[model samples]
Target: MNLFSDIRDLVIDTLAAMQGAGELPEDLDFANVTVEPPRDPAHGDMATNAAMVLAKPAAMKPRDIAQVLAARLADDARITSAEVAGPGFLNLRLDAGVWQAILRAVLAEGADFGRSDLGAGKRVNVEYVSANPTGPLHVGHTRGAVFGDALASLLDFAGYDVTREYYINDGGAQVDTLARSVFERYREACGLEPEIADGLYPGDYLVPVGAALKAKYGESLLDKGEEDWLEELRDFATDAMMELIRADLKALGVEMDVFYSEKSLYGTGRIEAAIESLRDKGLIYRGTLEPPKGKMPEDWEPREQTLFRSTEHGDDLDRPIMKSDGGWTYFAPDVAYHFDKISRGFDALIDVFGADHGGYVKRMKAAVSALSDGKVPLDIKLTQLVKLWKNGEPFKMSKRAGNFVTLRDVVDQVGADVTRFHMLTRKNDAPLDFDFDKVTEQSKDNPVFYVQYAHARVCSVLRKAAEAGIDAADATLGDADLARLGHEAEMTVIRKLAEWPRLVDTAGRANEPHRVAFYLYELASEFHSLWNRGNDEPGLRFLQEGDPATSQSKMALARSVAVVISAGLGILGVTPAEEMR
Candidate 1:
């Protein structure tokens, strides 16, 4: 059960009673009224802005409103005390039994404890890791994959019909470049010294692709020019690179529900169809954009072009769909792609882009807004750079041009679990420092280890209780007399457990899955503190030598912690550790 929501409902009900009694005016809007944790723990468990929100609307003083609302809230058995602090804010303290019920609910729910229905089964398409199909996924793509995968899982847990998607950039010039790079390696495989061109890919990862090309064509296309072989190798190399990319993603515990081809939007009347949809609304027109501000690029010109009135839909500038030439611009296909998503009947769309794509956010959002006629919402999240560190220095890898680190390199070094967990330690837009030494270190400094150790500690408690012949199964613990869990230290951990549902709601609404990692770390810290407290106070220990009832009560708390941690880790696509070495 969501304790905060339940308590908020109680507060709302009391306010309605006040209105019925003529103590407050009728028809007051409580949409903005919020009940959340107090800024300071010294205030109380939760603070509501009900009085403050109602005061101005009801034409009454905030303190006068708060005094009566506080008294009305105190009448509920669950609320132990309701105190008005500051001008009008009401702080509430809940009964100890409330926390006990939350623990029981957690044990009963198991892996579904923190699941929410906030999304209400709305269709959400999350497109991420849409990297160019040129080579293996590197560190930058790794961050997007982890963040997007975790976010899709979070939305799924929060009751969204989440579709994990990858848009393959096979229609771009980068894939053409990929074909030429592999052709050079093809020459090297055909017993000729290859010319490693200045703009060609130099990574050794393509060595196998070259060998496969020879095995397929076997020197038949060796002497052919670029015109004949370019198109053939473009398709062939794309398939090979996609296979490598798929394997790399699999190694990191990520699987997309769909792999959409960008080329599908071209030559299929889809681009014209999307533009015509906008044209019907007068959003598409022929106009010349102002010369780009600041330093003009070599290609800048003043010519009539087909542009979309993106500024009308909140974009900074109206964007071009087609240049002065007859050919469509790069953005034309993007507009068509999002139109395809809208046509698929998704209620919402999310694009997980690398930080460099920040410039495209506004134009893309404008496109979706115009194409969907402001019906469908688009949320774009950009994952920032990941800086690798090792041996107290910046770690560099030459796995690709620009000295990029491969996803396989990171995953192989510390396993998929550690790699996924550590990558999300920071938010998607915040630059992250991936220190090899820090993430694998078996200490509290390592959040992954700390959180995993907490789960392992609960397992150890279960084993110890089993050896002592105490029936500590979840069925028994869930039915135990949880009233024995009254100590302040024990209650603190339970209070944190009660925040899980609210956490899921807030984090899911914000579309920020990093908050899950943050919450798990905080919950793990509180649990570890309670475990240490048991050392000095025998009554707080999970195992009571002579009292099976009290031991069951305490062990129930430990198991409840494991339940929440397992659920949280599952959202992050990291396996919960039964035992950590």
Candidate 2:
């Protein structure tokens, strides 16, 4: 199904044959040889650097090797012409039937056409949107959620065993703050004047948590001290907020396989066990270190404390695990969590963090490397802020979220599909602007609409074909005489279609899911261009007047574009629209 890989394999096999015939030396390291689409279509279909790369190693001239390789490749039935250009670069033109064959392959495979076995079923753990479980998720969490979910799907489509995970930040002082905030609401529910103190959550979303606490505890424990109620309310409020978080994620069509609690690492000896693992590796020591350049933590004084030698493992400084107050630092539990993940036997780990967590990247990677002895690779992806605009001005925050816009706010305004697609239209580290006016427009400038319109257009074609009684179902389209689809406009789309499998492989390997969004945009652009041409040049249209065979051939090509777009959008976790509103 991967035409690029197939062509590359053919080029490699032809080189091996040249060696067998004594025309070239044996074992010239063809690993670096590549066959790729040429930059300019006028040059040829594919350009290979086989001759250019092997010239020095093969003790031959670049033009000499290219001349021989070109003749041998031209003999193959798949390649129509192989010409040497620019000092041994080989530009090849495949038989016109090859593009048709790739289109038929798309119809045959449908949703699974571009899937790859690149991961070889290796287990990969993707942790994202691990926002504090203190309130409903906000817009910052939304970008991480969409990016992480799409990345997990992309890795799965690339044949990895993926587990979507969310690490709940419920083990810190923030939970205590949540408890105190909910306690004020609880007092309000008890019909008493509640003291909504400073440094407490003031969102109206917590109003229900207070009512629920009163309903459960009654008036007996109403005036209890903080010691009696802090722990219990912390647990209760954490659960309530997690419920809200889950609803927000569900509204965006995200489902997590695990919700690991940071508190689970405490009192369970997991953190100690993880530190002991590092201790056994001679990576833990008691040492006094330099204070950081920025404003340092109170516990970060230059005193001897139990520290992990993270500098040896690639961190900027050795990090203290135990503070001067003898309590664990914030990083201890994170190290333990990744240790738990490594012990779970994942071959790789990926963490999706907010752009604010960029400072933790090196230390966290160092922790995982030390914990797993570098056997497990960790990649951290940071999603930057999303600036929302409405009516050509900056959007206001949600009062329900207390000065920040919640994930539900964005989803409720523009819908989940639009939110998801627009979030991915930019790279994870780049800032994104979600314009309400632009995203919902009917014009081609909007990527989500343009791509969805392509799929919907194909559906419209299928309907017209069915109404015409031409029987252009997906089942019959693959068997059409696709050779009739030889126009440059139609073949342009087929050339784009042939790049899907290669695109998925490259994007998955690089851990960049935004490439899928970009590819779909390009594919849609080509399809839309072809469709616009059909208005004036009747022969370029999907339907022909009274010619079912030619019409089916063209329809097959159009439907194949939808098939690829559906597969791409599926990886992005956005459902392809069958019909646009």
lDDT of 2 by residue, 1-581 (tens): 99999999999999999999998998799989988889999898889999999999999999999999999999999999999999999999999889989988998999999999999999999999999988999999999999999999999999999999999999999999999999988988989887878889989999999999989998766768999989999999999999999999999999999999999999999999999999999999998988777856775756789999999889999898999899999999999999999999999999999999999999999999999999999999999999999998999988988879999999998899999999999999999998988999999999999999999999999899989999887779999998898888888899999999999999999999999999999999999999999999998989998999999999999999999999999999998998988
Q: What tens-digit string does per-residue lDDT give for candidate 1 at 232-347?
A: 99999999999999999999999999999999988999999999999999998888888788856666777888999999999999988987878889999999999999999999
Alpha-carbon deviation at 123 in model 2, angstroms: 0.6
Q: In model 1, where is the ten-residue run with the lowest total lDDT?
A: 395-404
Q: What does the lDDT read for residue 242 in candidate 2?
A: 95
Candidate 2, pairs of clashing residues: none
Clashes of 2: 0
Best by TM-score: 1
* Regions of candidate 2 where Cα sits further than 4 Å from its true position: 294-301
TM-score against native, each model:
0.98, 0.97
Candidate 1, which segments miss by more than 4 Å at Cα?
296-300, 400-402
